[model samples]
Target: MIRSHSKLATALMGGLAAGLLLTACGGSAEPSSTTAASSAASTAAEVATSAAAEPITLRFIWWGNDTRNALTQQVIDLYKTTHPNITIETETADFATYWQKLSTQVAGGDAPDIIQMDEKYLAEYASQGALLDLESIGLDTSDWAEGTVDAGRFDGTLYAATFGVNAPVFLANTSVFEKAGVEIPDDTTWTWESFAEMAKQIQAAGGGEYYGVENLIGVDGASKIWLRQQGAQQFTSDGIGFTAADIQPWFEYWKQLMDEGGTAPATATIENQTTAVDQAFLGTNRVAIGFQWSNQVNAVQNASGQDILILRPPTQTGNAADGHLWYKSSMYLSAGAKTKYPEAVKEFIEFLINDPDCGAILGTERGVPTNLKVREAVAPQLDAANTKVIEFMDSIADELGTGGSVPLPGGGQSETIQRRATDAVLLGDLDPATAAEQFVTELKAEMGLS
Candidate 1:
């Protein structure tokens, strides 16, 4: 699910103000440089200037908070220092509004030259010819890990470059565990049943002060992992891969957790599920365990003021080998298909992916570096939290399954549907079996399969 904040509201109001200002000014006013050059010598200079290298202005757009924006701007500045003829203008919005604005801009033929993309929408845009083929543009991927380059492919063409790689992880607040006098379960050998039992124990020990884990029934990431564990893809080349039967058990599992007091109450879980990272159950020390992307470890630690430990999600059959974990592109960078300056955009993407200096500056904020060389070079410089994430990822490398399927055109709506269905189940409006059935039906309709 996309997290929201007051920043998005501020950005929306700013956009409105800019629109009103443009209306007041009656659009952009032109300068009369040509009319001022009356002398032959001045005309000659003007002609020469027109023939010389013109400055290339590229507009780039992304979704992030102030920290990411600052680091990205630094990288852009570094690039500009070397390529003085190129100029870059950046626009940013919170995750909740980024896609809405991007879709509107693209439809109006005002898309940015460079776009920060997510896996959920990459295929949706690429399949519609909105994104450029990176391979065709000659963006280098030779330094990237093997098969990592394929994360952004659609119909055998590379539409984007993997900017960073991550995987879903269970983030345990060690302090909370210690306070409850509960030992962290061995992730390598833990099954879903054992996981629930552990959570129940933690909650029992906390005396209402804390919960064992955040209620994750509505979390799309958890659903994906569950599907993978069942040897099912979330999306296939054909359509949605899992059936109602596949989904029923997942809902049942979480319902069981709620019944056993292993997680927060239904209403509280629904509220916390959508809360911002800094104020969520895990972030506020209201829960001992929670789920998040691996890249979020540092941020969660910073917010909670506690030592956070990353663990592999529980598997079926109590075996790590049965886990269907895989490395995913945390996000991607794609050039606009309609960009006027494709070559310059491609150059900038190349620098972002392969430059050691850029890697140092970014330092896993986006994710672990996609470029293997950069990953190796920046290892010693990472802080303790990031280092733990890196180590966890490396330890699980051999256990991962194949990469996940690309999300389909309407795939973005699946999370919302999941949330609604899960809410109905938790509120006693629908049983697990009926909720699962309704979920599949709505998801099919959303993906145009119904």
Candidate 2:
């Protein structure tokens, strides 16, 4: 199974801490007006002297929506109540803009003290000596969710802490399925061929204007799962793990789906990805099935104004374990290598990961907290969509896949290569076999391989 931890530990990873102190007057009774005034002044002076340290200002940065932003600000405010000597400044942006701005900041040596990281750039920044070693700096991971402690490490060195946890999910729009009069297949026994056939059925109902799904050809993460199911990997620590033959069938699988009218036309297939998420086929409710991260069900619902059902991805052997789905970090938290206040950063990471109050305030806005205790603490407050997401995760607890997925140095370019080659094949400019070969060759070049 993908989850190395026991089912109880895997689904729940039980987990979250903070103490604020208030000064109390030492006197037994109220004193005279003059005496009171003198004592008050003395107490203030004493407090100031005791807390004496250069006032620390930490710049914390992340990418998220209004909900996440509000909850994050609340958490920051709560932390400051007990920390008069520390001040935290915050910066937030959408996903694309956040990466671009962060890249520029890092390049110029002005990166924020605490940075929210994505898997795509974790390697890029950590490899360049931009991220701090969380363990060496003394950030505790004992209470974190199972299988998550090492998620942010590279080369056996810790570099990041998980922010939230999610996994790859096959999403089906129930509203669309109802409209087409097609029954949602049983996810437990579904195979890739049957999944494609279901998509084709939906397309027949749409009469060519709408497709049943997006082409799997250009989805890098799902593509990784496909390779993993076959006991190969899309990436390795040093280089690509699969040869052209291993992935050639994958390209052909998508070609057959597209040929059978299961997906959008090749041009629309590629163009839809570059558009805003809500404007895409899945979000717009043009498709019945597609792939999405587990936590993204809410966004898809908001865009489509329809209910979405999260399904285990179809597998080659009609077994959930064969799907090779694993729990993945939604994002990560890392301190800048040059952070002036390492101790303060450690305290902040501790509170964020271990405090129950923080969990209650933040809810599932950042995805489910990796600490199982936090998930339970925040469960009552999550809305219907988020509740569904939680339940779905629990149902598939025992089927999680493990290992075989380790992003290499240049693996960020995997998406670029996949898109280009997929476009060529989907547009009929190249056959599936030719596109697969080119995909491998181009990826090799990008990663500096021979």
Candidate 3:
């Protein structure tokens, strides 16, 4: 029941970022000119200076859009200015292709010095001994979200360090709700049945102008939340956590939503699921409610042009704790365990994560940072969209729970399996029970579980 850092952030926010950054960057307070402390500081600085001046070239690979790729390069260039002799070659790929390419490189024993890891596949790589033990190498997690750093651990060893934390939340369009003449549900005490009734009512209010809810069938977050509420999960340490019996009700519930006119049509719903957040049905104002990671509130809000209500998902019971809401790592940076330049790679990572200059240069493209000082330091410089995200995450601090874990290796492919089964159910090619069986069967096949 260990929780990720949330309210802990408020506790640490009192300290100013300047002094924290100074300390992280090795800047010492003024000491007596003749004191032993002064000499020690000078010796440390000289050693650091010597290391910075040594010629070291490291490669970093990540997947992102052009903006992220560009920002990352900007951070790399900034690092060069500080460490004049360090050279970092960069590689970038889109989300879909990055894992396959990284897998190929890893299998060939040609992995880059540093990698950008997603929670889904992190365990696979870390378990394969592909990522460096970040804890063993002295990367600081002092300012990060409590217990949540375990998101990057494999068998209790930290292999990666998260940039920040995000949660799965229901994004409700206030404008749509007002227009539909329906009050948003009391998410703190709402049940799944209440959620269904609310969606149906909203659709009835709209009279075909828009949908009440985005189709939840194929959306992975919805399934994860539902599974959690049932005391199950999408994945566990060994394999897929829920069986056909456990998941059939989920498919049936959403299928009921569709039959009752609470969701978009199957084709359009499937298409919406595949598109970017800003272009999804919810973002385009076609759905009154949607599910997304908390970090995506900015994108959806900007697209719909509203400060949407960020609500926790309804649970099996009316209690908020029954919702099993939890914080998830947005993403992480890991080093290759077999890296030749381990010290240089660690230094570069420390700079990107802990340095004030890096926090400013990288901005929040990687989601709001988990570091308390970095979050505070860069808060003022961010736009309203990102600022609102920070505020919303803080507001839900107490509701955040635990039990989120990465899929087991090939279990990362659960999204594809779930999508296929959902399409079958929605398109009438398979019944809910049948689709549920197929979903579990395929997932087990993917994970190579008996």
Candidate 4:
């Protein structure tokens, strides 16, 4: 939900092209004699020159801000040096307006050759036949990070190639915990009760700032994690999973926290937001804790200008071990289904994932690295903030649960369901039970399910 397109599309695409071309040509050449080799070299040089003379242009579109845009252009420049024959036409927009532009492009049948996609819209776009099967383009998941790779899969096939990894994590300001005299437990062993108790203690600490957590009843916030913990996914295996009733308890939990004064006041929670960390209770030091993805540690830390440490999501006590929240692609790269140069696009994706120099240039702007080799390559260059993220995520690697569940199905108005759930909780128009019932009803109606 937080838009973090680093404008590294050109670098990703360029590296992909060069890597693929090199892969194709370098693997099977034969040795030649000196006299014959001289003539052969001459002929090969001529062909290379001709290929270089005709530039291959790839149109790439993504979302980000000015810093990201400038970084992207620099990457493009680096990529062009290695791939002299390839020229990339860059298109970018802020996160708010990206979908509008992409939708128009899709409608006009002029979508860019390479597209950066999100999970919410992936099924819709892929089912519309707007995206190419990444597997068809020779990009396989055998080497990609499992969670990120899974996020790109739709139905049974992969429609996009992931750019990086994102896992839901909490950022705790240790200063708040110390001031409150509340001990921060190791995330792996902390349960819901322990978390609630900690919140209560933080509230008891004398300060204008309240206790432990901030409320996040909105979609892409607490609700998603709640659904996962209940062993009821947001959308079904076929994409019509749970309804409003399924999401009500998640809202109730926050209401309970608010009533206890273990979190920011209800008024502030309502005003605060999940997308904007600066608008979060924790950001204003109104609360000690906030729920968000690991990559957001920097944003929250920067907003609060305080030291922050990553914590795992609180575990459900009696629920079937659903594990921590699901990890997903920060974003994905897909080839336009209608691209005139499909092979080239495919090659571009492969490069983005595997090319060391490109991955180093792109860094972890998308989140953390999804490519094993690239992760290693870029590890040394990560800043203290990003390095902390990488280490925290990796520390919990063995404990992270599986999200091998099928991709959400298509033709079911899934996004509408998510929005409605968020609205009901934040607006307080409906209690948990009513919301759950309404959600189920709407879901069944949308899918025409029994």
- lDDT for 349 (candidate 2): 83
Across residues 1-450, which tens digit of lDDT does each residue of candidate 1 receive?
Answer: 134566787789999999998898995554422211113322233333222457677778888765677788788767766776676777778777889989999999999999999988987899899999888888888989876798888888999899999989999999999999988889999999999999999999989999989888899888899999998878876678899899899999999899899999899999997777877899989899999999888878888999899999999899998888889899999998999998899899989999998998898889899999999999999878778888988999988987467778888788899988999988878999999999999999988996
lDDT of 4 by residue, 1-450 (tens): 223444476678889999999998886444421111123322333333226456577788887644456556667666666766666677877665688889899999998999988776787788788998877767755667766776777877888788888778777888787788877777776777777778877887846556567666553545667677766766655655455666677767766766676666655555565235555577756676777777667667777888888887788863324454666677888889999888778767777777777777776667787888789888998788889989977877766554434334332354456446545655566676776676667667675566
- Per-residue C-alpha lDDT of model 2 across residues 65-121, encoded as one tens digit per residue: 655676787787677666766777777787777888898999999989999998777
Number of the predicted model whose TM-score against the real structure is largest:
1
- After superposing candidate 2 on the true structure, give the runs of residues whose Cα lies further than 4 Å from its correct spot: 1-54
Q: What ordering of candidates by lDDT runs from best to worst? A: 1, 2, 3, 4
| TM-score, model 3 to reference | 0.82
lDDT of each: 0.86, 0.81, 0.80, 0.69
**Model 3 lDDT at residue 101:** 83
Off by over 4 Å in 1: 1-53
Residue 442 Cα positional deviation in candidate 1, in Å, after optimal superposition? 0.6
* Clash pairs (backbone) in predicted model 1: none
Off by over 4 Å in 4: 1-51, 65-67, 140-142, 147-150, 179-181, 204-211, 243-245, 318-322, 403-428, 443-450
Model 3 regions lying over 4 Å from their true place:
1-52, 361-364, 380-382
Candidate 3: worst-modelled 10 consecutive residues by lDDT: 32-41
Error of 3 at 129 (Å): 2.6
Model 3 per-residue lDDT tens digits across residues 44-146: 3333433435666677888765556667767876776677667676777767878898999999999999999998898789888899998888887787767
